[model samples]
Target: MNFDFIRRDINAQKAKSQYRQLVCNSAASKGKEIVINGKNYVNFSSNDYLGLNNHLEINKALQEGADKFGVCASSSSLVTGYHYAHQALEDDICQWLNKPKCLLFSSGFSANLALFQALGKSEQSHFYLDKLSHASMIDGAYHSKAIVKRFQHNNIEHLTELLNRSGKYSTGFSNKLVASEGVFSMDGCQAKVVELAQLAKSEQAWLYLDDAHSIGVIGKEGQGSNYFADIDITMATMGKAIGTSGAFLTCSEELYEYLVNFSRHYIYSTAISPAIAWATKKSIELIKKEHWRREKICELSVLFTKLLAENVELVTTESSIHAIIIGDEKKALNVSEQLKKQGIWLTAIRPPTVANNSSRLRVTICASHNDKDIRCLAECINKAIT
Candidate 1:
């Protein structure tokens, strides 16, 4: 096949200021600093919301897990790869979320694909997703056989209308799933968890929450969306605040067994490293006991909002993410460069990752960040944008 179209597409992206390139970080430490090209900068683009990355206790647990269960699982969970570490991690998640059972995956993407694809087995399966849902959730929902509809972001009235429409035409589908992110990744705004849960119950639909961004940052014990409502199913990743690797889906025992038997992603792929699973248990333990970390994020976030200039607009969110909207893609990149020059590493979020003309500086405030860091960041951002 001719590859000229690939070059054309690349050129088009560059022309539109939408081209993306990977930057190598020589080192990342304490979830608040990264070394790129031998220059260290305060990291404000990380998803480590609770600032648990490279934590001492979690690191020690990882080493102990390796010593006890070895580093790798060597095979898929359906095979001989299911180990004590994996089972223990699953149990920990189930207990933390107060769910009947939990199943582990290599990442949040795989977990989402597994859940949607498994449940969306027939034409009767309908999925209503939030407009700002993560890419993984969108991909999984579209890839499934289910009829998918997207509602306005955080708009329960819109979702209710869509659900009513789906009910009017529903005849063959076995189930209806309503999927949303507990905390939107790009905007950092939260979904209406309580309202969605109530709507799902009233409509007799299954509520699925992708709590990847909320898990380690919300609730008194970091229970995330589960703290707001009794969601039917929830998925969260360990790579963020949990300071480990892998993802997990918490659900009813029947759903767990069904995924084990029928979810191709789970059945075909090798299990996550046993060592990481063991480390995750320790991470959750720390998350539960360390209320100070959550408080730190809140305190820092408030400081950041207070420090910004009057003209600068920020998306209000209780989560660690804060979006400073800069409509033009090129302008957003320029502002990002200016922040970098001032020793802050904030990324420009552009089209496709967000809506058209909604380019922004996606700022992540971690617990590791001090008041000084927030003040400096805010000053730099205010000066750069203005």
Candidate 2:
């Protein structure tokens, strides 16, 4: 009786076509193809942008790490969980991003939460986020003690106006922070990193970029936003492009110390898997050297675009994600089902993940996919949508 709202919310979600359920893969998925319900499907819904999900070397490193350092951290980093693997991974990330320090977390969501909660420690802190930032970032900002404002997505002018306006309400000196995703997860659009960095510099605000979808997919060396601009903070997940588990935050030494000392999430939580960290380090190394992988994604993306029907509303994106807007929840799901029948596994992104009536099939064109795969997906999507 006391938890009646839970049932009500579930029913409301079902009625609105916003209820979510997970689909389990029957076999090991290595990026390009997946087996589900004893059938194979071209995996367009995967986030392994660079197509290194099951690299032999990375897998070997994971095994090596498990043999050397065990799988789990066993304790909090401050207590005893900070293994050599984590330290080496952190060091590698710091060098790769050219940051003063790096800290590892269990996942990107928790890392975002920890960063916001640590930096927004007082009311004097003001956080401005892009309207289309990842849900984790929105949650982090809203849950923090700081005053939060949201600017129009990728609108530098709107962000500037908000930054200027924040001064009017602050009682005294304020710690201002601007947060955005380097590459928006759903829409596959990139933030104007250079402009944002400049704006943050002029306003004396820290620019925080969530590169969950960018790292290991963007930049010549896969340094992500750091290659384009000197960001104050960057958070990226190893699970997406690096094809491993856990996440890391790169920041200045001072901010790093502040987070390590004050962040409750960091202080109390157990460190990420040592094996995964080691594997992630190897993945980053591969990402940096494998220019062909990034090029493959670009080539396949262009081919996919060329093949899709003119009537299909696929958004142009430089990133791996290709969002085909269907504008209706049921319609999007129907299209997804059609694609599934044609041996393509594209998921329908519904409301709450996206805006109302903007449900889409988020297609991820990875390096693992070939021209044949692209043709199949495009033709299927084109026929289904048209």
TM-score of each: 0.98, 0.98
lDDT of 1 by residue, 162-223 (tens): 99987787665448899999999998999999999999999999999999999979998999
Error of 2 at 153 (Å): 0.6
Window of ten residues with lowest summed lDDT in model 1: 166-175
Q: How do the residues 238-311 of candidate 2 rate in per-residue lDDT, one tens digit apiece?
A: 88999999899999899899999998989999999999989988998999999999999999999998898889
Please give the clash total of every predicted structure, in order: 2, 0
Off by over 4 Å in 1: 172-174
**Per-model root-mean-square deviation over C-alphas:** 1.0, 0.9
Give lDDT for model 1.
0.92
Instruction: Extract clashing residue pairs from model 2.
Output: none
Candidate 1 vs. true structure, TM-score: 0.98
What lDDT would candidate 2 get against the real structure? 0.92
